[model samples]
Structures are given as C-alpha cells and as structure tokens.
Target: MENFNAQFVISFLIIALGYCLKKWNILKEKDGEAMARLIFNVTLPSLIIVTFHSITIDSSLMMLVVLGFVYGIIVAILGLFIFRKEERRNKGMLGMLIPGFNIGLFAYPLVQGIWGEVGIKYFGMFDIGNAIITFGVSYLIGSYYAKEDVVLNFKHVAGKMGRSIPLMTYVIIFIINLTGLSLPGTVIDITSVISKANMPLSLLLLGIYLNFSFQKSYWKGIGRVLGIRYGVGLFFGLLGFFLLPVDDMFRYTVLIALILPMATSVLPYSVEFKYNQRFVGTAANLSILISFVLLWVIGNMIV
Candidate 1:
C-alpha cells in the first residue's frame, strides 16, 4: 500500500474482524460497551500522556480550539432552525446530534497512524473545544427539549465536562507541558505500553458497534441529519483548507474534524432524553461509513 492505504487497510481489516466476531457469536455488540470503557479509562489517557508529554504547542494551534467550539455551536443553531417545525423532543434530539464530532474514538486512530504524534497533538488542541460542546452544550440542548422537566445550567455542564477522563487528561498534560514539567519516567514507560493498544481497540470497537440494518421510517430524519452534516462539513472543510494560511496538517485536521462521525454521546442523549434510539443509532452508523469513505478520498488527494 502506498501513502495512507496501509493504515486504512489495517483499520478496515480489524473492523471487519470485529464485525465477524459479533456475527459469529464470539463477541456480542454489547461487548463493545466494555471495550469502550477500557479505551476511555486506560488506553486513551495513556495515549494522551505519552503523545503530549514532549510536543511543543504552536500558538497558532490554539485556533483549532476556537474553530472546534464555534463550528459546533453554529451547526447546533442551524439544526434548530432547519427543524424549527419539528416537535420539541425531535428537534432537540436532531439539533444536539449536529454539533459534536467523534474525535477520540474516530479521529485519533487515523491521525496517529498518518501524522504520528505531531498531528495527534494538533487534533488534541481542536478536541478541547469539541469536548466542551459534546459534553456541555449538547446536553443542554437535549435536556432543554425533553418532555420531562429538567433543570438546565452551566454548573451541570461543567460538572459533566470535568468528569471526562480524556478531556481531563488533555488538560493536565497540556498544562504540564506549558509549565515545562515532565511526567515521571516510570509513568511514561507504563503509559507507553498501555497507549499502544488505543488505536486497534478503537477501530475494533467501531466494527463491533456496527449495525447494517436501517428502518424505512428513519430515512427521512437520517437524510436530514446526514445531508446537513456533510453538506455543511464540505463547505467548512473546503473553506478552511483553502482560505486558512495554517500549515497543511492544521488545515487537514480542521477539514477532517468537521467531517467526522457524530459524537458518541448522541446515542446516550437519545436514551436519556427519550428520543428515538433506533433513529439515532442508524444515523450515527451512516455517518461513520460516510466519513470513512470521505477520509479515503481526502487522504488520497492530499498524499
């Protein structure tokens, strides 16, 4: 394989293996939940610690934080406007889905493989703002529109964001790097071993979670979600790539970040806020497939 075809090939093969495991009854889809837990708690944090430990922060990279945040907020507002005629519950469900990207599980693997630690560091900056909206603003949107009377406030959102292991890891490592401090060498050695599993585990998790079934009822809403998600993603991805004077990696990060799968939290939000679970799951799956294909095209173009 030339260029990124190597990583993509390995990724697809692992994902297929995972799906086959599920199909063969060796690993159930629910098994993915346990895998997800491990990834978030251990492997992901380890990757963050090891990757960010020695990388220098570019002042310009901070702009990714802003773009990640601003784009999420804008897409969210657009969702509401587009679905203004939708029911409160449906509107909130769809609106919340628009804003967030699946950076930790989806973006990190491809980036780590293609651009190595340098790209991971840049995407990490972008994810900080993405994390805020994923945990905070999206929660607010879902709760605000739920039929149940739920109290909404900034404190609640902050608490949620504070509890994110990956986000917390990012903040701590970023701060430590800023202060010119290093993690203890022993800690680095342990984390290095654990972090090696992050990418393969993430790719496998995606495959295990895949469901090829889609309902006839879902196409209408799913179409709306995907059409806007990619349509707007294309606009921003192109604009950022062409107009921004940033380095190629930063621009590429922006393009891919905007175009990634919807946030994993959207499914939980559906369950929590009493939206249609089937619809949310199907739409999210479709996004993953579409993003995979788009990334291939984008990768081939840039490489």
Candidate 2:
C-alpha cells in the first residue's frame, strides 16, 4: 500500500513540476512535443523491446492484444451511439476521445512501479492494439465526421502508423519472440538504459501539455462525454474483474486501464477535424484528474 501511494505521489509530483515549469515559462508547450518525440521514438520503443525480449512468448499472451482492440472498438461504438444526439461537429471529437487508452504515457509507468516488467509486458501487448486504433481507426472516425469535408485518405493513416517506432517495434519484437529467440544481452543492456527514461519523460510531458481552459458552452458536451466515458469504464471494468480468465496481475492491469484518461491525441484530432478545442481540451484535462483519482482507488484495492 505504501509502495502504491508513494509511486502515485511521486508520479503526480513530477507532472506537477512540469505544470509549474510551463506556467513559470521555464518550459514551453512546444518543448512538451519534443519530449513526446523522445518518448515515443526512443524510450518507449526501447522499453517495449526490452520487456518483450525478457518474457517468454505464449499463444495465450495474444489475449492481451485482442482485449485491447476489441474493447476499444466496443467503447468507441458505444460513445458514438450515446452521443448521436449531439451536433455533427461534436460527434467526431466525442467518438475519438472514447476508445484509446493512454497506456504508454500514463498507465505503464504506474503499472511498472506496482507490478514491474511483467506488468509492462501485459500492458505493452495491449498497447499494440491500442496504437492501431489510435493512429488508424480513431483517426478515420475523427476525419470522417469532420465538419470540414475531409478527403478520407487511408494511405495517410497507414503512413502515420508506418512512421510509428513503437508500433513497428511491437511487430518486430513479436516476430522475434515467435521464433523463440531472445535479443542479445548487450543489446538489451543498451536499451535498458534508454528505456528507463520512458516513465518520467512521459509523465512530465503530459504535465507540460496539460490545459484546463473551457468556455461555458463546452460544459454540456463535456458533461455528456465524461458521463459516457466513465459509464463504459464502470461496466467493462466490473466485467473484466469478475469474468476474465486471466490471472490476478492481468486483471488488475485491465482494471486500472479501464479508467485511464482520454488519449492526448484527442487535442490534435480536435484541430484536424475542426471540432471544439475548448471542449476537447477541457475533457482531456478533467479525464487526467479523474483517472488519477480512480487509478489510486483501484490501485489500493488491488495492490
């Protein structure tokens, strides 16, 4: 219990430090994008490689990936249905925010602190499918429903996924694991050093990017979005807890992930789709704060 609280406190504090730095003009928002690049391109991929390299591969492990993809689609569909009454512009943003988990940047560090590399492996596998939806499926939805006529170019989405280092790393590592091969010790050692930076860098970048501004008009949309998000969260979270065939650690991981914040990608999607940035930004911020509290409660219960 002490370990969980301590890790949560330290993680939140680092985020607070980044927020303070940004507010103080010590770190600009653009700097957060640079840190994000560092995390996604270098550290996160390294972490995935190192974690997958160390774990034995099994057919059952595929369940983790399947769970991610299936649940994401489910939640996304649910969000679309629940908010069907909203205006066209709001639908895209609402749907975009619903499905993807902020696993790499938000959930993994806390999971690692609580459950170590094994937890990472579970969440890492889950992240593979989450990445697919984030970059591919969710991107399509956002673009498709944009108030502006968006030329649906799947090639563009595919190009974005192709450019993703972490997703590619997942594929490469999975292939290697399939061959019953492990990475060279020296390679793992080198990546270990780089991968270690992922947690703090990710959380700190999230802090730097945090925004809370919102107009009065945004609250109606924001309220409906949050309501649907946690509504789905509560239902599936309980189902996973009581019904999943997985072991305790995987169950616990899934439960925590259920309540994670809206993906940071939502902000950019709002811009791309000509959705309300104020609403999206406000929802994103509130999700972070709300997810933190939910995660703390769940972490204590399960830890």
Candidate 3:
C-alpha cells in the first residue's frame, strides 16, 4: 500500500508539473503537435520494440489481448446504443471516449510497475489489440461524426495501418524473435535510452495540451463524464474479476486498465469531426485526474 501510494503520488506530481508549465506558458500549444508526433512516432515505438523484443509469447498472454478486444467492442456497442438520444456533438464525444483508453501513455508504466516485466509485455499485446480496434472501429465511428466520405478504401486503410509506429515496431520485433535474432548490445542500449523518455515526455505533453485548452466552463461536464467512465469501468472490472478464468493479478490489471481515461488522440478526432471539442478535451483531462485517485484505491486493494 505504501509503495502504491508513493508511486501514485510521484506520477500525479509529474503530471501536475506539466500542467503548471503549460499554464505559465513555458510549454505552449504550438509545441503539442510536435510532442505528440515524437511520442507516437519515436518514444512509444522504441518502448514497444524494447518490450516485445524482451518477452517471449505464450497462449495465456494472447488470450488477454483477445479479452481486451472483446471488452472494447462491448463498450463501444453499448455507448452507441445508450447515447443515441444525445445531441450529435455529445454522441460523437461519447463514441470517441467510450472505447478509447490511454493504454500507451499511462497504462504501460503503471502495469509494469505493479506486475514487473511480464506485465509490461502483456500490456504491449493489449496495445496491439487496442490499435487495431481504434483504427478500424473507432476510426469509422469518429469519421461518421466528422461526416467524412465514408468509402471502403483498402489502400488508404492499409497506408494508415502501415504508418502506426507502435504496431509496426511490435511486428518487427516479433519477426526478429521468431527468427531467433538477438539485439546487439548497442542497439538495446539505444532503445533503452530512448524508451526512458516516454512517460515523462507524454505526461508533460498532456499537461501542456490541457493548460492551453482548459476553460472554467468546461468543468460542468466533468461529473457526467466521470459518472459514465467509472460506471463502465466498475462494471467491467467487477465482471472480469469474478467471471474470468484469470488469476487475481491479471483480473486486477484488466479492471484498472478499463478505468483509464480516454486517449488524447480523441481530441483531434473530435475537432475533425465537428464534435464538441471543448467537452471532449475537458472530459479527457478530468478523467485522467480521476484515474489517479482510482488507481491508488485499486492498488491498495490488490497490491
């Protein structure tokens, strides 16, 4: 419990520092696009490569990925049905927020801390499933909100999939492992160095992005978002906890993973789709804040 509290406090403090930096204009909105790119294109990919390269695959681990996908799909379908009566704007926000989890920015480190290297490796697999769903189903839903020319363009879809750094990194690492190739010491060292930057950089960017966009008026929607997020999280957490065949640790991890906030990527998608960007952005930031408290509570129970 003490360890969980300490780690939770440290993590929240780092995120708070990021918010303060952005609030003071030390980190501006203009910097966000580049920072996000760096995370998506470089740091996260490097971390994935390092993780996948280090871990061996197993059937049980693969089952976790399938389970995660099933959970995401279920939540997405539920959101679509439940939010049907909401305004188009709110519906769009719900669609994006429902299935999108910040697995990369937050979950990876938190899970790794709790369960060690094996947990982190499982997280990478979870992320792979997440990426596929996000790009395929979530993209379609978000695009519908954006009123994009919905067409079946396999080539365009392929190109988008090809550009995903984390996914590609996983594939490459998996192939390397399958071929029984070992990473050279120098390469491992380089990846390790770059991978270390991911958490701090990502949290800082999140803070900066929030500071530039946050408004007092947006706080009104926070309660509603939290209600939905935690409600769904608890439902799945408890359901998986009792019903799944997994052990306590795996069950706990899945529960906490579900409780994480919507991803930051949802903001741009909301903007592009003419959704209520203010609501979506504010909700995401607030959800992340709430997650810290929830993590501390859950960590105490499990750890």
Candidate 4:
C-alpha cells in the first residue's frame, strides 16, 4: 500500500522535474517535440512489444479489444451531440478529445507499478481499441472539421495507423502471440532496454508540453468539456463496478480506464485541424492531474 502511494508521488515529482526543466530553459519547446517524436517512434513501440510479447491471446482478452472500440465510438457520439452548437472545427476537436484515453504513457506506468504485467495486458487490449480512435477516427473527425474542404480519405486513416510505430508494434506482437511464436529472447532483451525508458520519458514529455494558462473566456468551454467527460466516466465506472459479472481485477480495470484523462494526441489533432490548441493542451494537463488523484485513491482502496 505504501509502495503504491509512493509510486504516485514519484511519478508526480518526475513530471514536475520535466516542467521545471522547461521553465528553466533547459528544455526548449522544440525539445518537447523531439521528445514526443522519440517516444512515438521508438520508445513507445519498444514498450508495447516488450509488454505484450508474452501475453496469451484468449477470448476474454479479445473482448477488451472489442470493448475498447465500442467505448471510443460511444464517447465520440456523445461529444459530438454535446457540442453540436459549436462551430464545426471546435466541435470536431472536442469530440475527438472526449473519447481517446491517455492509456499508454499515463495509465500504463501506474497500472504496471500497481498490478504488474497482467494489468498491462488488460489495458493493452483496451488500448488496442483506443488506438483505432486515436489514430483513425479522431484524425478523420479533425480532418473533416478543418477550415478547408478536406476529402474523406479512408486510406489516409488506414495509412496513419499503419505508419504509426506503436500501433504497428502492437498488431505485429499480437499476431505473433496468436501464431504461437515466442519472440526471441535477444529481441525481448533489446526491447526491454528501450521499454524501460518509456514511463519516465512519457511523463517528462507531458511536463515538457504542459501548459497551465487558461484563457478567461475559454474557462466555460473547458469546464463543460471536463464536466461531461467525468460525469460520463463516473456513470460508467459505477455501472461496471456493481453490475459487471467479471472478477475484481476486470472490474477495477474498467473503473480505472473509465476515469482516465483525454489523450495527449489531442494537441496534435488540434494543430492539424486548426482548432484551439491552448484549450486542448490545458485540458490534457488538467486531466492528468485529475486522473492521478483518482487513480491514487482508487488504487489504495481497490488494489
């Protein structure tokens, strides 16, 4: 129990260090971009492979992948309806933000620290469905809402996910698992070295990109977005907790996932779609802070 609480504190301190490094000009804005690229292209993919390489594919595990897809679709529809009155660009960005969970860097480390490799595999499946929304659906929504008339290109969506290193690693690793082929120990050893960097680097990247300033006028929009997000999250959390027939671990995973924050990918999507980047950026940081508290309390109680 003490270890769990300690992990949360250490995580926050690392994030704070990243923030401080940026504030002191030790890490510039472009450095943040570089770090992000490193994580997305290299460390993250390695982490995905290392963690998932040993997972046994089963019907129950596969169900998490399906639920992940369904969860994203449900939240996106709700987000679109909730923000229907807004201008198209903002509407699309908000909708994208609501659905994608920050499971990779944010949830993975915390879950790993508390629940070990088994927990990661559960969330990893959940994240597979999440990858669809983050890499495909969200991109399409953002492109649709762009000021310029953009063609709806399904190929573009597929290509984006295809090109993503992490997603590709996930699919390849899972396929290998299904085929009953174990990753060579040398490959696992190499990936393990790179994967160890993922958590600290991810949190550090969050701190590097952290933007705390909230425009006075944007407060209303931010409040509404967060309010709807957590409200829906709480509703689902309770439903899965009391009603689901799954074991305690499954129920807890669902609860933890429900309360997770919006994906950091929203910042790039906001940029690509020409939406309000500051709003999305601020919301991302805020969600991390909010989710940390929620996860910490829940971990102590449930785990």
Candidate 5:
C-alpha cells in the first residue's frame, strides 16, 4: 500500500519534472514530438509485446473489449445529442473530443506501477476497442465535419490500425496469445528491458505536452466537453461497478479506463481538421490535470 502511494508521488514528480524541463527550455516542443515518436514506434510497442507475451488468455476478458467499444459508442452518441444545436463544424470539433481514451500514455504507467501485468492485460484489450473508435469513429467525425468525403470501410479501418506500430504490436501478440505460441526467451528479455522505459517516458511526454494557455472565447466549449467526458465517464464507471458481476480488478480497470484523460490523438485531429489548436490543447491539458486528481481521490477510496 505504501508502495502504491509512493508510485503516485513519483509519477507526479516525473510529470512535474517534464513540465519544468520545458519551462526552462531544456526540452523544446520538438523534443516532445521526438519522444512521442520513440514511444509509439519503439518503447510502447515493446511494452505491449512484453505485457501480452506471457499472459494467460481468458474468455471472460473479451467482456472488457466489448464494453470498451460500447462505452465509446455511448459517449459519442451523447456528444451528438449534446452538441446537436451547434453548427456542424463546432459540433464536430467538440464531439470528437469525448470518445477517445489516452490509455497508452496516461493510464499505462500508473496502472503498471500499481497493478502490474494484470492491469495491462485488461486495459490492453479494452484499448483494442478504444483504438478502433479512436481511429475510426473519431476520425470520421472530424473529417465529416471538415466537409471531407470520408467512407467507413472495414479495410480502411483495419489498414489504419495495421499501420499503427503499437496497434500492430498488439495484434501480433494477441494472435500469439490465442494460438498458444511463446515468444523466444531472447526476444522476451530484450522487449522487457526496453519496456521498462515506457512508463517514465510516457509520463514525461504528458508533462511536455501539457499546456496552460486558454482563450476566453473557447471556455464554454472546453467546459462543455470536459463536463460530458468526465460526467458520462464517471456515471458509466459507477454503473459498471455496482451492476457488473465482474471481479474487483475488472471493475477497477473499467473505472480507470473510462475516466482517463482525452486521447492524445485529439491534438493532431484538431490540426488536420483545421480547428483551433489552442482550444484543443487547453481542453486536453485540463483533462490531464483533472484525471490525475480524480485518480488520486478515487484510487484511495477503492484501493
């Protein structure tokens, strides 16, 4: 128990360190981008391989995956109704923000620290569903609102997931798990070593990307998005806790997964769709802060 609390402190400090590094100009914004690339292409994939490699596959775990997809769809539909009165572009920009979870960067490290491989296994499957919605639904919404002709092709979604390094790694490991195949010991050792770097690096990246600037004009939009994201998320989480027959670990994972900060993808989506970047940045940063505090409070209550 002490170790879990200590892990939170260290994780928070690492994030603060990253923010301090940026403020002092020791790390530039481009450094954050580079760090992200390293994590996405290398460290994160390695971590996925390591986590998924030795786990026992369970039939019941599929529930997490299905529930993940269901949650995203539910929140997205909520966003649609909530933003129904706004202009198409405004609706699209705000609506896309509600569905995705920042599981890899934001949730993984803390979960790893506190819950070990058990946490990763559940969240990883949950993320599979989360990824589909993020790249598929969120992208379509953004592109659609931007007046782009976007088709929801199965192959297109699969191809997009395939092209993503972390997702690809996840698919390969999942196949191996299902087939009862084992990775070579040398391969496991190598990946496990590399995977150790993922947590700290991810935390650091969050700090680097955290922004404090806010435009007064966008405050209402930001509040609306945050309110929906956290409110709906918490409601679903508590509903799952009491209603689902799943064990405590499963319930804990669901609670944490649903309430995670905005997906890091929101920033690039804003850029690609030509929405206001500052607004997205502000909303995302605040979400990160909000999630951290909520985790601390909720973690104490439940754990």
Candidate 6:
C-alpha cells in the first residue's frame, strides 16, 4: 500500500512538473507538438518493439485479445444507443472516447513501473484487446461521425498500422523472439537509451495540450461529458474487478485501465466530425485528473 502511494506520488509529481513546464512557457506549444510527433512516431514504437519482442504468446492469450475487442465494440454500441438522440457529431465523439482505452500510450509505462516486467506482460496482453478496440471499433465510430463509409479497409488499416512505429517495433521484436534471436548489445543499448524518454515525454505532451484556452460557456457541457465518461468507466472497472473470474493481477490491471480517461487521439477525430473539441479536451483532462485519484484508491485496495 505504501509502495502504491509512493509510486502514485512520483508519477503525479512528474506529471505536475510537466504542467509546470507548460505553464511557465518553458515547453512551447509548438515544441510540444513536435515532441509529441517524435514520441508517437519514434520513441514509442521503439519501446513497443523492445517490449513485444521479449514476450511469448499462446492460444489462450490470443483468445483474450479477441474477447477484449468484442467487449469494447459492445460497449461502444451501447454508448451509441444511449447517446443516439444527440447530434451525430457528439454521438461520434462518444463512440471514439468510450470504447478506446489508453492502454498503449499511458497505461504501459505506469503499469510497467509499478509491477515490473511481469506487470508489463500483463499489460501487453491487455493491449491486444486495446489495439482491437482502437483500430477496429473506435475507427468505425470515428468514421461514422465523419460520415465516411463503413467498409473495413484492410489495406488502409494495415497502412496506418504499419506507420505506427510502436506496433511495428513490437512485431519485429516478436519475430526475433519467435526465432530465438537475441538483441545485439548495441541495439539493446540504443533501445534502452530511447525508451527511457517515453513516459516523461508523453506527460509533457499531455500538459502542453491542456494549456489550450477553455471557454467559460463550455464548462457545463464539459462537466456532463466527464460525468458520463467517469461514470461508465467506474461502473465497468468495479464490475470487472469484483465480478469477473479473472486472476487478481489482471482484474486490478483492467480496473485501472478502464478508468484511464480519454485518449488525445479523440481530438482530431472530434474536429473532423465537427463535434465540440472543447468538450472533448476538457473531458480528456478531467479524466486524467480523476484517474490519478481512482488509481490511488484501487491500488490501495488491490495492491
């Protein structure tokens, strides 16, 4: 329990420092975007590659991944029906935000830091579920809102997936692992050096993103949006934790992930769909804030 608190404090402090840097103008908005690109394109891919390469998989784990996808899509469909009478744009944003979890970008490092390599392995298994949700269902929702066709473009999905440095890195690593190939000392050294930057850089990007000027009138809508997000997230998280027959470790991990706020990726999608970006941004920020507390509480209970 004390260890959980210590870890939370450390992680929160680092995030706070990022906020401070952005507030102080030390990390300019433009620079932050550039850094975000680097993290998204380069550093993150490297980390994924390295981590995935070292993991071994089996049929059961693959089944879990499929289960996660189906579960996520089901949740999104439910959210859509609930929010259907609302504007198409809002419905779209809800679909994108609700089904997807930030398992890869944010959850990975935090879980790895707290639970070590084994924890990360658990997270990776969860990520397969996350990937399916993000790429499969979330994309459909986003496209729906954008009024794009519902056809599944395997080529397009594959292309976008290919450009994901992290995904490709993971694949490469997984191949090497399958072939029983060890990473050369120099490559390991390089990955170690770059991978170290993933967490701080991610937090910094988040902080910079939060620096946008929020409208006073949007506060009420933002509150409602957050209310829905946290409410559903908590319900599922607690239900999964207490009711599911999963192992203790995965139960706790999924609970934490369920509460992981909104992903920044939703912003561009919202814009494209003509939804309220301010609402999405505010909701995303609030989720981050709420997640800190939620994780602390859950960690104390489960850890």
Best by lDDT: 1
lDDT (Cα, tens digit) per residue for candidate 1, span 1-303: 284999888888988898999999999978999999999989999999998899878778888888989988998899889999998888888888888899999999988988898888888889989998899888899989887576677787788888899989989998999999988999999999999999999999999998999999989898999999999999999899999998888888988888999989888889987888989999999999999999998888876
Q: Against the hidden true structure, what lDDT does model 1 obtain?
A: 0.90
Worst 10 residues of 2 by lDDT: 54-63
Off by over 4 Å in 3: 87-90, 152-155, 211-226
Of the candidates numbered 1 and 5, which has the greater lDDT value? 1
Clashing pairs in 1: none
Residue pairs in candidate 3 whose N, alpha carbon or C atoms collide under 3 angstroms: 146-273
Give the alpha carbon lDDT tens digit for every residue of 123-221 in model 5. 998998898788878877776776655555667656776788887788789899889999999998998999999999999999898888778898899
Backbone clashes in each candidate structure, one number apiece?
0, 0, 1, 0, 0, 5
**Span of 10 residues, lowest total lDDT, candidate 4:** 141-150
Best by TM-score: 1
- lDDT of model number 3: 0.74
For candidate 6, give the lDDT of residue 246: 71
TM-score of 1: 0.97
The pairs that clash in candidate 6 are: 45-165, 45-166, 49-169, 49-170, 53-173
TM-score of each: 0.97, 0.94, 0.88, 0.95, 0.96, 0.86
| RMSD of every prediction | 1.2, 1.7, 2.7, 1.5, 1.5, 2.8
Off by over 4 Å in 4: 148-150
User: What TM-score does candidate 5 reach?
Assistant: 0.96
Residue lDDT tens for model 2, 1-303 = 998899999999999998999999999998987888889889999899889985776655687788788888888888889878877767887788888878889998888787789889888887888889888888888888885676799899999889878889999998988888878899999999998999899888878978767678777777887888788887888799889887887787677777888877777778877787777778888888889888888778777
What tens-digit string does per-residue lDDT give for candidate 4 at 1-303? 888888888888888899999999999778988888898888878878888888778887787888788978887888888899988777877777788788887887777777777888888888899899888887777888776677799987898889878788889998898888897999989988998888899888778777777778877788887887788887888788789888777777788888898887788888777788888888887888888888888778876
Sorted by lDDT, highest first, which candidate order results? 1, 5, 2, 4, 3, 6
Tell me how candidate 4 scores on lDDT: 0.83
> Which pairs, if any, clash in model 5?
none
